[model samples]
Target: MNDKVGIVIVSHSPDVAKGAADMVRQMVGNEVPLAFTGGDPGGGLGTSVETILAAIDRAWSEKGVAILVDLGGAETNSEMAIEMLPEDRQGRVVVCNAPIVEGAVMAATEAWGGATLDEVRRTAEELSPA
Candidate 1:
């Protein structure tokens, strides 16, 4: 019953994304697949579509993948990354509209528990304001 789903964290600051990923890893241990992408290619505060895409690829799982982003641009770039995926792969990827840090922690924990993608996304989204 290996029902683990993968997670991808995207943020404008590399440190923020990495830190959140670290926290999630601490929470879920190695039971879930996690990847993070932050900052521009030049190492400045910005998100990159390519980086996001790569992180998604690194964290790819048969169960599914959920993405959490910090801000509007991060969300936009994440959408672009998903779009760039092949048609077959795109359906399994979801961009979650939840707070990056909290969402990553919640999603990772749910995935570790063998939750499906919808269940993990719901767990993360439940933390957002109504």
Candidate 2:
């Protein structure tokens, strides 16, 4: 089977992250690799670089990985997570600046369609809340 790009969702609320993941799964079925990290390590309203790193690892694919963050520190933590990856692999990951829910859906669908990492990221970025 051809390896497809994977998706990671980051959010300040665990429920938001998980809910968005579920929606993406419904949209893409089992064909896409999907993972999510939300809330703090202590189960509070925040994000952790470690958790984001683990989620990225879970969604890792040779094709590449795209990450969508909800808000606030999620973007920062996601960037840190990507930076934590080895230099060789860091370029394989992208943190998208799209709304988490919409971006996750678009990214997962693009991945399910076997799009390249850059393709998936572009698809997600094309989505506008306006």
Candidate 3:
């Protein structure tokens, strides 16, 4: 796996993140790395920063990583996650606002082929009509 890509999804509810991850996994298979974060502050519906950060690390370890966020806490959570990542790995992570389904599908497709984080993000942004 000289060239590989990883995925991370963040949302207001863990269900949303997991659902998106599951769909992407089904589409792309289990070969590549995938991470998801969501849930409420007091409830167990969301993952801790450590969990998300670990996933981010694993994703970055390969080729690069792309992060997709739904809305609400997903945005703030992703931003915090990026800040917590090691400085060297910062460039490997891209936080994008593409729709969960379309963005993830496109990102996973490119990731399966080992696309760079920037490439995946650019593709996602291009796909986004917003």
Among the numbered candidates, top TM-score falls to 1
* Model 1: ten consecutive residues of lowest lDDT: 1-10
Which residue pairs overlap in candidate 3's backbone?
Answer: 38-46, 39-45, 39-46
**Residue range 50-120, candidate 3, lDDT tens digits:** 66686686565457788887765666777787888778877777787698767887888877877777787
Candidate 2 structure lDDT: 0.90
Q: Report, for every candidate in turn, its global Cα lDDT versus the true structure.
A: 0.92, 0.90, 0.75
Q: Which residue runs does candidate 1 get wrong by more than 4 Å? A: none
lDDT of 2 by residue, 11-54 (tens): 99999999999999887797888899899988799999998999
Better of 2 and 3 by lDDT: 2
lDDT of 1 by residue, 8-113 (tens): 9999999999999999988779779889989999979999999999999889898989999998999999999999998988989999889999999999999998
TM agreement with the true structure for every prediction = 0.96, 0.95, 0.85
* Error of model 1, residue 125, in angstroms: 0.2
Candidate 1 global Cα RMSD: 1.2
Which residue ranges in model 3 land beyond 4 Å of their true spot?
44-48
Query: How many pairs of residues collide in each model?
Result: 0, 0, 3
